[model samples]
Target: MKCTEVNRLLNPYIDGELDLQNVLAVEAHLQECPRCNAAIAGIQTMRTAISRACEPAKAPLRLREAVQAQFAGTAAPRQATSLSLGVCLAAAPGIAALLIVGWLALAQPWNAQSNAGTAQGTRIVYHLAGGNHVKANLRTLKNHLDAEPNLQVVVVAHSDGINFLLQGAKDTEGQPYIGALRELRARGVEFRVCTNTLTRQQIDTRAVVPEAVLVPSGIAEISRLQKREGYTYLRL
Candidate 1:
């Protein structure tokens, strides 16, 4: 099998979705290809980082009480209802997961200083996941810096957020966004583009604007910044 064929099959192979024949072909190709092997390692590292970052957080007492109340409120009258304490307890985990997802979707900007033991200084990780808000987000960043000159900012881009970081990418005025990116870089803001997105989208590394640095995984990088570097998380 050729490198291109193996590259196409890498994800399926990792997921154990490839049939035996194709699996063997990909493995054989990987054995002789350093590049493919490194790709697999990078993916596995990202998976591990994500897994660590996603470990189930204990539901807050209020949320748990609300969930329990919700379950109780919807139950039929005692004589007709089959709901029990054991059933509610058993269902708590799944309900908590859904509630957590919803909470994340509705979450506002979080300041690291509010948490004990977080590092000092105003360190922020501004996360971007869509192309539509690039200009607005950058404007917000500029305003933030103007308000707090000593603040440290890192812009982490993934998915369609990487669009503005591509070479020749333009803003509403038909001017390239790279000029704004360069200005931001000059102001000590770091722009990180995800290499995983690049590979999945088949974008050449050189196609990214020189002002942005490529990281293994934008999500993983965000996780690291929040958990390990004490950076506040702001998704915009």
Candidate 2:
């Protein structure tokens, strides 16, 4: 990996946010480059200094209660080790955005209460296996939904197409698609991402926007939706 790339990813690496491939690449590069190794050490030292300098504070009771309430409906509530209410307060904006996105994704297909109504409709499964024409495809889907209110649309993304639904992902102009996704979602469109692709590509499921649910296999999902559910298939 280039020095520039290594430098850019150092923080994410330290934060335990890098995917498997990146972790390996960064470790390999750190072994060969003394400069980067020194940089990593310096960053660690700085973090340690800040941690020691700051006074420890207890988490607010209200915040803890709110978090508990939010995950109360989940089949298996997610837990974070070493994550405190203070860390959540420190990154509230970013954390709130991710939480909202996660709520949107998890609420759709996973929540039986919500799915009870959404699951029954004229279904159409859209296959997305490539990144090309993402915007155009989304636009088309939106237009189709506008024409048919009772139609249920599900977008299954895999391979290169998965990047479109990744968190903070942008188009050529550096514009986020979450707004558009939210709009479509409000109109009853669903988005599902493939776990197989994520595993093969060494990507963390959290890296994807919360607007998309994670499916076991994109191709298998498409097939099931078409056959068992009588969903019409469209590839883009």
Candidate 3:
């Protein structure tokens, strides 16, 4: 084994886990390589330090109670309880932080911690009724998202309004409406089409913007969002 290969096994070896073959290989290399010998010695020192610092066992809660009771017997009744409680509560914030870190570690799309100090999320809603010009309102929504930024906007299509995002939809100039919706969606604009309207009109959802999601009923979804999710609604 090379110096690097032997170094890789040093920690496990110092912890007494190296296999027979690996031990023989490591021994052969260490006899001749000063670098590997030093590496093994360094890892052995680290193992010794870690073993002395901590052992795999239960927490120190029992010891903590004893410490708290040391002053508890002399203090007044309320003071003793409060001091004991404070001693026990000392780990609360740290435990909460550890839980949050663990959750964020697994929840992140990438393996990373979620920053609590990041900007707050944005939530905005757009109401589209039957027969209104869709291209114009969609353009306005796009402009706001592009310029103001940080604004989370949802376009709710209901009733005849579902045509705004119907498959193969076009503007008065014959430009494909789905293209603009796609572009806006790439910038984070959410398109929600009312299922009630689609069922009534028998429109094919396959033709709508791929970003458009079907809600139970667009009007009801809009109302629920405004009342419950704290969304500010705008009608165009």
Candidate 4:
């Protein structure tokens, strides 16, 4: 990884948001790049300082009761009555302090934890089984890859879904899918086809797209990625 890429990923790395692949890349770069290492150290120091500065003090009982009542769908106590100018001036300091404390208490670090994989970047297994929406599915995959450069994505296509992976296949709108598929492949997306489905449909393996890897079973691949590799599954 270059210094520019490492700089872009530094915040996520600090917040534990990077996947295993990216984490390794960033760590490797940091070891060789003294400037990048110092930058990360400064970031860590800033984070620690802010966390300590924003440490929350206990909230008043009234505020706790009001918050609890809101969550429980119960009526809360009425707001305080209007105060005279002199009374308002007297209470302003305390109100400001309360607001500051409350805000600090609610403040949190930007720690993006992936539910799919613990201590790793996000890994997703997208299931494509409908012919009518093949274009949409591929489009969504491209959008996801564009949005999350660090994401690990795999598309498992079987049955009708495998139609899109066939050589010379066009989408519902009669537009070819190869161009988009190629671009996504360049972005680290993996396309998998079910050999079982091809056999059932009497489709030739030679006719499948060169980009797709043949898996024994689509469902089995999905299950294996989810159970063994901690990939999140989504069907479309």
Candidates 1 and 3 compared: the better one by lDDT is: 1
Tell how far residue 47 is off in model 1, in angstroms.
29
lDDT of 4 by residue, 20-92 (tens): 9999999999889999999999999999999989987897664554344222211222332121122222334
Tens digits of per-residue lDDT, candidate 2, 57-173, equal 987764454344334344432433121223322434434454343333333334443332354655666777777556766776776676667778899999988998998888778
Q: Give the worst 10-residue stretch by lDDT in candidate 2.
A: 80-89
Sorted by TM-score (best first), the order is 1, 4, 2, 3
Model 1, residue 226: C-alpha shift (Å):
0.5
Error of 4 at 73 (Å): 28
Candidate number that wins on lDDT, 3 or 4: 4
Highest lDDT scorer? 2
Q: What is the alpha-carbon lDDT of model 1 when measured against the actual structure?
A: 0.70
lDDT of 3 by residue, 40-79 (tens): 7777788789999988986466445433422221222221
Using TM-score as the yardstick, the better of models 1 and 3 is: 1
Q: Backbone clashes per model, in order?
A: 0, 0, 1, 1
Tens-digit per-residue lDDT, 1-236, candidate 1: 88888999999999899999999999999879999999999999999999989997997664554344323222222232121122222434434443333223222223222442233446767777777645766776787778767668899999988999998999877888987888889989999999999999999999998889999988778767765665555555
Show pairs that collide, candidate 3: 167-207
Error of 2 at 9 (Å): 56
Worst 10 residues of 1 by lDDT: 75-84
lDDT to native, each model: 0.70, 0.71, 0.62, 0.69
